[model samples]
Structure formats: C-alpha cells, structure tokens
Target: MPAPHILSVFDQDMDRLQAQILSMGGLVEEAIRDAALALETRDDELAARVVEGDKKIDALEEDINTAVVRVLALRSPAAGDLRTVITVMKVAGDLERLGDYAKNLGKRVPILAQAHRVEGAAASIKRLAKSVRLMLKDALDGYARKDLDLVRDVLQRDVEVDQMTNALFREFLTHMMEDPRSITSCMHLLFISKNLERMGDHVTEICEQIIYLETGTRPEARPKGTSTAQVDVPYPGSRT
Candidate 1:
C-alpha cells in the first residue's frame, strides 16, 4: 500500500487526468455540433474555426499521454487504479479521433456551400450529427460518474447512429443517380455522414473503456444496424 501522502498525490494526479479528458470531450462535442450547424447554415467561418480548433484537441491528447506515462511510472497503480488510468488514456485517444472526424466535416463545408443544394440533405445530416453528439455526451458522463447504465445506453444508441448513416448513404446515392451534377456535393455529404458514423463508433469505444474500467471484463458485442460499407469514399486530406 502506498503511504497516505503518496496516495493523496495519486488521487490529485488522477483528478487532473480526468479533468483533461472531460475538457477534451467537451471540445469534441462542440466541434461536432458546430460542424453540423456550419453545414446546415453554410457558415464557412464556423467550419474553419472547427478545423483550427482540432489543434487544441490534439495537444490535450498529448498532455494526457504524458500524464498517463508519469502516473504509471511514479504510482505503479495496481488493479482498479491501474484500470482507471488506462481508461483515461483510451478515452482521450477516442476523443481525439472524434475531434478529427468533426474537423473533416468542417473541411468539407466550404466545398459543400458552393455546390447546388440537395433538398433535405443538410437537415438529415444535422439529425445524424445530433444523435452522435448525444451519444458522446452520455458516454463521457458515464465515464465521469462511473454510471454503468449510462454506458449501456450509449452502447445501444450506436445502432441508431448506424441506421442514420445507412439512410444518409441511400439518400446520397439516390441524389447522385438522379442528377449527375450533384455527384460532387453528394460525395462530400457521403464523407461527412461516414465521419459522423465513425464518431459514434469512437464514442462507443469510450463507453466500452468505461465498462472495462468498472468491471473486470468487457461487455458482449452490441447490435448494429445495416452496414454502410458500400460507400467507402475516403476523405480528401486523409493519408493513403
């Protein structure tokens, strides 16, 4: 057992780590919300801001990584304390990926703004974005509060995000088939939808980490909706 003073230091370190994770989560949630609104409102400026804000998320992830390494080296946390530190690291990585997806959505906004409007597409995307944002928020809450019920709810909600993505995939395909000119815009929308779907996946990962931290084992695989695997268009800026 660690001395009382050492335990106090570990607790303080853990608290700081948790605070950083939550801060990163908050920034990612904002990015998703703002990216969706920018798409809906054709607000290029807001989208640009989302893109720029990704740097802060990346920096937070680095800080979390450094903190995790320090804790493991200094505290040599055992059992549950070890699990909590590991979970924090995993959650930070997930949030950073979520931020990247949101930034990808933001990157497409200006291109989408200039393209001819596809009726109802923006609204559908906003709905999809909103769903994933809620999932992310609940997942973070689950982690912070150690609420297994909230974690389970987040796991279930991932299916809804998948279903939404499938619907958007079909809609984009239909628009592309009906009007060849809409292909460019619809392709961008497809990428955005995929990004949102992937965001939900990362949020589910965070929830899974929370579950593992609380329990010794991971939960069974959750159910999924129709696969949107047919549309695998890569983001333009993504590395090969």
Candidate 2:
C-alpha cells in the first residue's frame, strides 16, 4: 500500500487534473456561444475569432490527455482513482469535439453572410445553439461538482436541442422551396444547425462519462427523446 503522504500527493494531482478539464470545458463553452452569435449577426469577424480560438481548446485537450497518461503510468492508480483518470481523458475528448463543432459553425458564417438571409432562420438557430450551450455548461458543472443529478438533467435536456434542429430542418426546406435564391444560405444554416445538434450529442456523452466516473458502471441507454424522421426530407439541391 502507498504511504499516507504519497496518497495525499496523488489526490492533489487528481484535483489539478480536474481543474484543467474544467478550464478546457470553459473554452469550449465560450466557442459554442460565440459561434452562435456570429451566425445570428452574420459577423464574419466574430466567426473568424471563434475559428482561431479552437486551437486553444485543442491545446488544452492535449495537455490534459498528457497529464492523465502521466498519472496512470506513474501513480498506478487503482479502482476509483483509475476510473477518474480514464473519465477525465474521455471528457477532454468530448470537449475537443465540441470545439470542432464550433469551428465548423464558424467556417459556415462567411458563406451565410454573403447569401440572402432566410427569414426567422437565424433566430431559431440562435435558440437552438443557446440550449445546447446551456446543456454543455451544466454537464461541465456536473463533472466539476460531482453532481449526478445535474448530469442526469443535462442528459435529458439534449432532446430539446434535437427537436429544435428537426424543426429548423423542416422550416428551412419550406423557405428553399418557396425561393430558390434562398437555397444556398438555408443550406449553410442547415449545416450549422446540424453542428449544434451534434454538440448536444457530445455534451450528453460527457454526462455519461460523469455518470460512469461516479458509478463504476455505465448508465443504461435511455430512449432518445427526439425523432429524426424529418431528416428524410430531401436536401434543397437534390434531384430525384
């Protein structure tokens, strides 16, 4: 068995690791928010800024991953300690993916800015992005505070984002059919909506990681609350 002092040092290292994960999560959350804002305002400058910020989020993920590996290799963490390190690594990956989604959203902004705006599309997308951002924030808080209830709540909230995206998809289709000129802009907006929806998925995955971190076993898969049946609707430019 490790000596008491050594265990204390290990605990401290774990605390630092958790802090780093939270910090990285914060950057990801910011990226999501800014990307949505850029899309809403058609602000290419802000979009470009979000794109650049992704590098910071990526770097943080790499740093956290390295630290986790070091702890696993040097400390030889067993049981819960091992689980915590593994979970942190997984959570970092989720955060990194969220960053990528944000970057994707950013990349679409210039295209959207140049094209004709679809009435009401930007507002609805903003709402969708906000919901996903909140879920991500709660997921990060759940991880930091070790609040299982919060994690469970975040898991349920993703359905709202999915429903919003589905609605946006249907609405965009109508706009494209009514005015062919709007197709290009609406298509980009659809892509952005899909990115935000995917971010919600990754947020839920983070919640799952937290659940496993607290409980040794993964939680049972709950029925997905939202339906993607609307996705069957043909793309704007597709010809049958």
Candidate 3:
C-alpha cells in the first residue's frame, strides 16, 4: 500500500488527468455540434470555426498524454488506480479521433455549400451528428460517474447510429441515381454520414474502456445494426 501522503499525491494527479480528459471530451462534443449545424445551414464561417477548434482539441490530447506518462513514470499506479490512469489515456485518444472526424465534417461544408444540394440530405446528416454527439456526452458522463448502466446505454445507442447511417446511405444513393447532377453533393454527404457513424464507433470504444476500468473485464460483443455493405454502394475513397 502506498503511504498516506503518496496516495494523496497520486489521487491529485488522477484528478488532474481525469479533468483534462473531460475537457477534451467537451471540446470534441462542441466540434460535432458546430459541424452538424454548419452542414445543415451551409454556414461556411461556422464550419471554419469547427475546423479551427480542432487544434485545441489536439493540444489537449497531447497534454493528456504527457500527464499520463508522468503518472505512469512517477507513481507506478497499480491495480484499480492503474486501470483508471490507462482508461484516461484511452478515452483521450478516442476523443481526439472524434474531433478529427468533426473537422472532416467541417471541411466538407464549403464544398457541400457550392455543390447542388441534395434534397433533405443536410437535415439527415444533422440528425446523424446529433445522435453521435449525445452518445459521446453519455459515454463521458458514464466514465465520470462510473455508471455501468450509462456505459451500456452508450453501447446500445451505437446500433441506432449505424441504422441511421445505413438509411442515409440508401437515401443518398436514390438521389444520386435519379439526378446525376446531385452526385457531387451526395458524395460529400456520404462522407459526412460516414464521419458521424465513425464518431459513434469511437464513443462506443470509450464506453468499453469505461467498462474495463470499472470491472476489470471487457464488455460482451457489441450489438450491431444493419450492415451498410448490404446496400452495395462503394464507400467514397474505399480501396477496391
């Protein structure tokens, strides 16, 4: 057992690390929201802001990584304490990827704004993004509260996100086939939908880490929605 003073310092370090992870999660959630709004309204300036905000999110991840290294090196945290430290690092990485996906969504806004708008595509993308954002929020809350039920909720919600993405994929395909001119816009929306779906995936990963942290055991196989592959549309930029 660590001495009383040493344990106090370790707890303080853990608190600081957890705080940084939550801050990063907050930035990521905002990025997802802003990117979705920019897409729906075709607001170029707001999209630019989402892209710019990614830098801060990236920096926070770096800070979290450094702090995690310091904790591992200096404290040599064991058992549950070590699990908590590792979970913080894993969550930070997932949050960074979420921010990157949001930035990608923002990057498409300018192109999407100029292209012929696919009917109802922007609204659909917004809905998808909103679902992902909520999942991320819940995942972070579960981690903070150490709530297993909340973690399970996030895992279950990911199936809904996949279903949403699949439906959007079909909708976009129909638009592209009917109006060839809309292909360009539909393609970009496809990318955006894929981004939001991937964000759900990352959020799910965070919840899994939370489960592992709390239980020292990984959760069961994740529930999955309909496979997008059934639709037979090649994902944009996918390798043959």
Candidate 4:
C-alpha cells in the first residue's frame, strides 16, 4: 500500500480505538456513579445494574486490546502516532482496572445498603465518591481532548480524595476503638475508601499516558515561570 493509504487506514484505526476507550471510560463512570447512588439510596437493584455494566466494561477492554494489537501489526505506526499507540494501549489497561475498582465499589454497596449504615461513613463517603467521579469524568475528557491543564485538575482532585480517605479512616478508627460494634461495618467502610484511593491512582496514570501521547516524552512537572502546557479539557456542565 502507498504511505497515504497506510496513514488513512491508521487514522481510521485510531478513531475506532479512541471510540472503544471512550466507551469503556463511559461504562466505568456510570458504574462509579450508580454504585455511589446504590449505597446512598440503599437500592440493591441499582447495585446489581452497576455490576452488569462492569461486565460490559470488561468486554470493551478485551475488544480494545485486540484492536490495538491489530493496528500495531498492520500500521507499524512511527513517531507521534507510535506514541499514541503505546499510550493508548496502557491507558486502556488502566481504564480496565478502573472498571474493576468500580465493580468492587458496587459489590460492597449491599453491605452498607442496609437499615443501619456504618457511622461516620455515609456523608463523608458520599463526598469522597462525588469527588472521585468528578476526577474520572475530567480525566477521560482530558484524554479525548489531550488537555494537560484538565489532567492537572484531575490530579489535584486526586489529592482531595486521598485527603478525604485519610480523614474518614481516622474518624472510623476512632469510633471503632471506642465501640466494638463497628468492627465489621468499619472494615467494609475501609474497603470502599481504599478502592476510591486506588481509583484516583489509576486516573493519574491515565492522565500521564495521555500526556505522553501528546508530547512524545514522559510528563515532567512544568516549572511555574515557563509557559504552561496547552491541553483542552471539555466539560459539559460548567464555565469553560
């Protein structure tokens, strides 16, 4: 094939791959949102739906991997396109693991989705959940638009989730130390918080991957005085 033909094929393939990644990311976001709602509303049915969405996410991951491998073999893409191929492969895996984390969150919903919820976890966990969901949403948007500043925003929100997780753990520990009854429920609460923290870590990884794709280099912390990295994150419901 001519170079232009190969390039055209590669472009089409990249578009398909991006679509697959976005689909997986969308499922992951839905799972996270529904899992939080399930716990808060004590709706076991919603939790079940989140679990099912997780299966679709897994399938999407498998399809993405297959698509990436096909492109790598056929296109042998070089330079910027090569970086994109590599970044996208890793990003897809990170997103898949993120889907698993969301599923884990859903699985735990039934435990806390009961008449008497664990003390100190309800409101705090809700806040943390919302923060993580927002981070995921922005992180995916950053990927689509190659938006570095938006990625930085997602990283900052990760710190917020981490801080909230620590606070919640401390509060839960203090309560359990005082009251023996909180042992089982507190452990469940810990599991949920830990998953949220790990999700934040994965979001950071995906953001870094997207950065690498755009810049052909691992992301270096931008010095304040130098020009800021130009990346556009598209947010649907807020001032741009």
Please list the C-alpha lDDT of all candidates, in the order they appear. 0.92, 0.87, 0.90, 0.77
* Per-model TM against the reference: 0.94, 0.93, 0.95, 0.87
Which regions of candidate 3 fall more than 4 Å away from where they truly are?
A: 233-240
Candidate 4 residue spans exceeding 4 A from truth: 114-116, 221-240
The candidate 1 region of ten consecutive residues with least summed lDDT is 231-240
Q: List the residue pairs that clash in candidate 4.
A: 147-231, 147-232, 148-231
lDDT tens digits, residue span 42-156, model 3: 8999999999999999999999999999999999989889888888888899999999999999999999999997878888888899999999998888888888898899899
In model 2, where is the ten-residue run with the lowest total lDDT?
222-231
Model 3 Cα shift for residue 6 (angstroms): 0.5
Tens digits of per-residue lDDT, candidate 2, 123-203, equal 898898889989989888888788999999988888788888888888887888889999999888888888888888899
Clashing pairs in 1: none
Q: Per-residue error at 199 for model 3, in Å? A: 0.8
Q: In terms of TM-score, which candidate is stronger, 1 or 2? A: 1
lDDT of 3 at 236: 55
Which parts of model 2 are misplaced by more than 4 Å? Answer: 226-230, 234-240
CA shift of 117, model 3, Å: 0.8
Write the residue-wise lDDT of candidate 4 on 13-74 in tens digits.
99999988888888888888888888778788898888878888888888988888898888
lDDT for position 51 in model 3: 96
Per-residue lDDT, model 4, residue 106, is 77
Q: Number of backbone collisions per candidate, in order?
A: 0, 0, 0, 3
Score candidate 4 by TM-score against the native: 0.87
> Comparing candidate 2 with candidate 3, which one achieves the higher TM-score?
3
